[model samples]
Target: MRRFIDSEADFIFVLAANVASIQAEQDAIGFDAPDAKYPHKNAEGLCSFAVLVQEKFSDNPILMKMARIVQAADFKDQLDDHPAARGLQLISGGFPIVTSNDHETAERAGFLYDALYASIKDNVGL
Candidate 1:
């Protein structure tokens, strides 16, 4: 957060458990909640970051697949909605996020996400 004090990102992502206050303050959305402008689900019944991104650019195949994957992974109880979700969770579980190294864990996971995105983009089928 302190890093953003000097430099602000074009899109502020608040993927937290409790996003009520943040939504009110920043007019942002969350992993599962919606604000005044954004809805929790889209017309296609997509939720999470999926709906948000889709609203802007729905023509891309890669983004749509990523959104589907994200929608499944966002729900803790329905992690099995997508086979990759459990694998991703397990892989991330191996990280040092528990030791308060969230930034480090996220940094390590960045490449993994990039790889996944690339895989999705390269493949024609979901």
Candidate 2:
């Protein structure tokens, strides 16, 4: 997945979104509707992923920042800490854009993930 993202391969973003969404759901255990898709159920695992990314990509400062974003987006409720949390919640829940087809949903959201990655990549200097 990392390679795909780096190489600008096709379908990488949507694939990532789908994979992340599914893993978050399966790894998730207990939570009420609307909140279930978020990482509230297993925050330890989510944070652990960030740690793993940090350890693996210690040289890539941008990836490390992404790790922090993932952690905060999944765990932090204070929007100031993780402004993307609300958007992640909505997208994961398939709110306004989700359709009956998972593939289609991923395909549509692929662009969004691509934009997000681009934003992260562009802000690497910051």
Instruction: List, in order, the clash count of every candidate structure.
Output: 0, 0
Q: Candidate 2: lDDT over CA atoms? A: 0.53
lDDT of 1 by residue, 1-126 (tens): 122122443344455444666767875543445443445655556664576556665887877777777677756676888877777667766777454665666556667777777898778665
* Count of clashing pairs, candidate 1: 0
Instruction: Kindly list the per-residue Cα lDDT of model 2 for residues 1-126, writing each as its tens digit.
Output: 324324543332224335455446556322212233332334455554365555567777766766666666555453356667567656656634556675566566657656766788897655
**Global local distance difference test of model 1:** 0.62
Q: For residue 87, give model 1's deviation from the true position in Å.
A: 1.0
Residue 122, model 1, lDDT: 75
Top TM-score model:
1
RMSD for all candidates, in order, please: 5.8, 8.0
TM-score of model 1 (CA atoms) = 0.57
